[model samples]
Target: MPSHRAASLLLALSPCLIAQTPASPAPLDGIWLGTLHTGGPSLRIQIHLHQDAAGKWTCSLDSLDQNGVGIPCTLSSATNPIAIDIPAVHAKWSGSLTANTLDGTFTQGADMPLTLERQSTMTKPTPPATPDAALPPADATTIRAILDKDLAAALSSGALAPSTNAGVTIGVLAHGKRTIFTYGTAKPDSVFEIGSISKTFTGLLLAQMVEQKSVQLNEPVRDLLPPGTVAKPASGSEITLLDLSDQHSGLPRMPDNFAPADTTNPYADYDSKLLYADIAHHGVSIAPGAPFGYSNLGVGLLGSALANRANLPYNDLLHQQITGPLNMTDTSVVLSPSMRSRLIQGHDAAHNSARPWDLDALAGAGGIRSTAADMLTYLEAQLHPNQLPATAASTPQGKTLPAAILASHTIHADVPPGMHIALNWFRADATGNFWHNGATGGYSSFALFNPDKDFAFIVLFNTTISDKSFADRLGQHIAQRLAGDPAVSLAN
Candidate 1:
């Protein structure tokens, strides 16, 4: 893999004028006052912003004290709100400007309960300034402390079912111009199950092949699949590769003939022979490019189609075309013993014991494993889609994949109030945030980045940590700290 200058978070746009920022911003320019509503109760949080003469914003947070003396806090992302994530603490936060309030949520870290709050104009009198020097400034340690709290909670919360005697592993990288703050196990070469993250890789590689003329997105799959290969769309003899990738093929989420020999490692038993045979027998139910339905089968079919045209095994094709070029050594469909050793044991429950489940049959769907380090590179490539080695932001193929990658980030469809699913990647909770996440039996993961803002983030947990309460509160905390301004947090 060639060296890629990893991508950064989306560049900050002046905080949006959802409602104009207070015209005569008070101490508000520096000190942020808000109440956190965790449902069980509310806690007061005070944040003091320090700006050098240059007008850049850096924040210091303190949960309100008994005497109201602002104690220093360790909220993550004070500099880049949209890129909020801290693995050591096992939490993420984000904020948005609402009609009148900065509505946000903060997910609990490893062991904490999540909080949700709306921080807006406060009438409370400002406390007399103590020597700002009394408090040590925020840095990686502070962020890690906050995240560590969450990590402990996540570990206890069944994120690690003993079925696998493994510790949960998490990786986080803060993309600042001066340095990248990375935190994880010292075993630098570990491989993690990035799971559905493979979908993003597949999307990008398909864009690459499209660039190389090795695969055409518009050509019907029938043109490539062996003759008589039966797909659901009997009426339309052709379903384009884009159809499969974009989830427009009208293909069922799981093929009718997809029963595998090993249910645990579902895809492991379905090799090319099985994939080809299945397509030939099982039929389609809808026309190509029809309604939107998420289909893992669609992803696998696309991968198989690409491999056939490229004449390389699917894993090797990924290496030669994407991971290898980006130097993602720890990312692959298959893991070596050395790399595997670093893997935190995957547990099936928050704090219970569980076994590892296999999905070899779903190779193209969610079979790839990776570490946070490798994902940072992938995250970077996404923000600067135009800066890629050979893919354009708008054009389908060529040097630099900006155009092609950008197409994947478009708001394809709405999933929730602040979420949408586009191609393989989806926008997470933040209004302007675009991201994707995945889960294996013992893992829960997240990757988010905004190209327009030049910012990015990735978070992976060993267990399912998607309970709305925890994630909501944690996300809120990170948002206030970062403030959705990438340049402030990451500006060199």
Candidate 2:
């Protein structure tokens, strides 16, 4: 006879015991798609399962909306109550399998209900390779020899993808002169994803819309959404567009349902549905307009809201408002066929090939890909606002660039002593310098400029290893030297 507590424990153990009864092997090898519903967003998830001749089970997870794929995983037990584990992202799924379907819950830090249905058709991905169009070695005279040595050492230090010839492209604009430097596999035209920097564009879009009076920065964000789409959080303070742009919207770094089916292409399948679902479910954790808290969701939501106001997609509004007028042909949410040919392969810190990211609903958070030349042209516009076409200061459409630029560069939040938030731009309160950094699974980018000194530099890399900081060092070194203050340590 068992005591009551012991009986309760046995009752709980009965499920696992029953589940362990090795029912027939469920023939789990196939493509399975599912949706994960959470308090924040609903993520679209996929899994690829296969069995080796040796009878070992292997699985790959994909978060369709997250632009992630082929996330390595292992399958436990071939029958009902199967468990799938992905250690790379510290995520797991446990559920009962019935016929060709799996009903389970996925957990990372939190839990979400998921249902997976098998599909007959799924294609394999191509192996990554360096672009054949890579240009011959170009002069790197503009790059400091010390910085170049550091770049070389960092790439060889086993911090980046092994055997992959990774490198960086440097572009500098200073004192009425421009210089371009290419190293490793990079060229002036090599394209790399410019991750979170896309937020700056979203901020600019906000400013433009505000100037047009189509949206108000300080107004409640619910005004832009379809009525009843988003449930305001208990926080009495309404989140404003300005709060979204300034990184203070109180949204989490990622939504609860941001579980990736494929970690490589993390944002591919996230749609507007997920965005709204997440917002309605979670609302803000802190007060809507609380202190600084960096959030991809905040900026992403801002982009969606702005797009709604303009009756356009985020990409289209970005083009009509900024990229088109700036003649930034190479900057876009999607690469053109020509750009694809020039796209450099990206690698992770472990020397493994990393799949490029694709943002569907979250494109505004970090979706644009660009080249060094194009970024330099962009920096030129930022460095010398007067050089832009007279109309560039004011979009013939409702956007007003002058006002937007001023608004973007104005300090909106106090960060650490040296830094502050200005719209989407990170400003150096001490020096009035503007800079931003972006990273994806396999790439990183840095841009810094001082309008008064007419100096700026852009560093783009094809690897997101710890060594990627070489770009920051190089950029800071160049900016400082160009400012005639080479003694300033980047570490400072």
TM-score of 1: 0.59
How many pairs in model 2 have backbone atoms within 3 A of each other, for residues 3 or more apart or on separate chains, i.e. clashes? 27
lDDT of 1 at 233: 62
Give the per-residue lDDT digits (tens) of candidate 1, residues 402-491: 555666675555432244556666565454666555555555565666554455555554543432212222332332233322111110
Name the 10 consecutive residues with the lowest summed lDDT in model 1: 1-10
How high is the CA lDDT of each candidate model? 0.50, 0.67
Maximum-TM-score candidate: 2
* Candidate 2 segments exceeding 4 Å error: 1-162, 232-235, 284-289, 390-399, 465-468, 484-492
